[model samples]
Target: MIIAEQKPIQEIKAMIAGYQKVLIVGCDTCVTICMAGGRKEVGIIASCLRMALQIDRKKPQLIEDCIQRQCEWEFVDTLKDKVDGVDAILSSACGVGVQALAERFPNKPVYPALNTTFMGMPNEHGLWVENCRGCGNCGLGRFGGICPIARCSKGLLNGPCGGSQNGKCEVSKEMDCGWQLIYGRLKTLNQLDQLEDILLPKDWSTDRDKGQRKMFRGDVYYEQTV
Candidate 1:
């Protein structure tokens, strides 16, 4: 899932300064699981913003709403009525959702209230760690399911750097050595021999370097411009 952090109140304050009627839109899916832009969070932010704006002697009407998602066109299209009544939108969704609103509405000013952090999952309560870079390629089989490109401090493809000691990376004692985890996983699977195999240089063209990635369906005449 895509993890996001909510922007501070002061920054959001400056966004809707001139707009009299502002809508605080939340995404109920990815941002919800990450505890940043859910319906509950939307209410919390709206209350905070209301207080902040009131103190400034600028009382803007805040309308709070949460949709199933703010990324897909189908989900975003549902906000047409609410958006028509607002001067600006303070989106609790990620940057993609903000852009979707900007493109869909074309005239309304949409501001992002959350910073899109990364594609990761929660490791513990209130703690989310990045696990994948979404490089558009999968090489987990050779590394026993651990991704050296993302987990490794140096992004080493072959083996652990000499900088590691006692399962902890030299980068920090709190950080686990990526290769150490891989070695343990491979040992458990009886695939330690796979470590000897050299992996070729990663093909990064499959990544976001090319710009404007898209997905489509051959069975249907539709393309998703992501």
Candidate 2:
């Protein structure tokens, strides 16, 4: 899932400082699951903004609304009524969601109230760790399901680096070596022989370097631009 965190209140206030009316939009998909830009968060931010504006004697009008998802056009289209007569929009969704709104409503000024952190999941209750970089090229099968490109500090495609010591990375004593985890996983599955295979240098052409990648679906007869 795409993990994000809400921006600080001061920064958000500054973003919409001159706006007399603003709409706070929330996304209910990935940002919601990460507890960042859900309906509840939208309400909280709206309330705080309202109070802050009131203290400044701005008499600002604030609207709070949450959609199923801000990334999809269908979900974003539902905000037609809520966005009416709004001077600006404060999106509590990730960066993608903010851009989606901006694309959908070109005339309206849209601002992000959250910072897109990473594509990862929560390890425990409140700890989220990045697992994937979405490099577009997937090579997890050869690495015992562990992604060296993301987990490894050096992003090594082959084996552990010389700096790895006793399953810990030299960059940080608390960080686990990505290759060490892969080795253990391969050993458990009796696939340690796969380690001897030499992996060529990664082809980064499949990554975001090409700019604005798209995936086409013949069955659906649609193209998804990411």
Candidate 3:
């Protein structure tokens, strides 16, 4: 999931300082799970803005709404009429959501209310840890299900660096050495010999860094379009 965090109240206020009317848009997907941008979060932010504007003796018109997804046109289209009267839009969704709104409503000014963090999973009820970097190629098969590209600080493909000590990484005491975890996992599976196979250096060009990434499923494409 794409993990994100809401921007500070002060910063958000500043962004809409000049606008007399504003719309707070939220997404019900990834950002919602992270408690960053969702219907609940949208209400909180809207109320906060209302109070803040009142304190400033400014009657700012604030409207709040949440969509099933801000990345899809169908979801965003629902706001067409509501957005028409708003001076600006404050997107509480992920970066993609903010951009999608901007693209959909070219004339309206759109601002981000959260900082897009990373692709992560909830480690617990309130904690989320980074999982994937969205590297174009995946090598989980070779690494015992551990992702060296994202878990390792240096994204080393071969093995643990000298910085690993007792399964922990030198970069941070809280982080487990990704390669160490791979080794242990493979050892437990009686597949430790796989480690002997040196992995070739990653071809980064094939990954996200190359450019905008896209995937197409012909069946789904036609069905959705139709």
Q: Give the 10-residue window scoring lowest on summed lDDT in candidate 2.
A: 217-226
lDDT of 1 at 133: 88
Error of 2 at 139 (Å): 0.8
lDDT of 3 at 52: 84
Worst-scoring 10-residue span by lDDT in model 3: 217-226
lDDT assessment of candidate 2: 0.92
lDDT of 1 at 107: 92
TM, every model: 0.95, 0.94, 0.94
Q: In model 2, which regions exceed 4 Å deviation?
A: 222-226
For candidate 1, report its TM-score.
0.95
Question: Which model, 1 or 2, shows the larger TM-score?
Answer: 1
Candidate 1 residues 1-226, lDDT tens each? 9999999999989988889999999999999999999999999999999999999998989999999989998999999999999999999998888998999999999999999999889999899988998888889888999988889999899999999899999999999999999999999999999988898888989889999788767898656587
lDDT (Cα atoms) of all candidates against the true structure: 0.92, 0.92, 0.93
Model 3 regions lying over 4 Å from their true place: 222-226
Worst 10 residues of 1 by lDDT: 215-224
Q: Give candidates' CA RMSD values in order.
A: 2.3, 2.5, 1.8
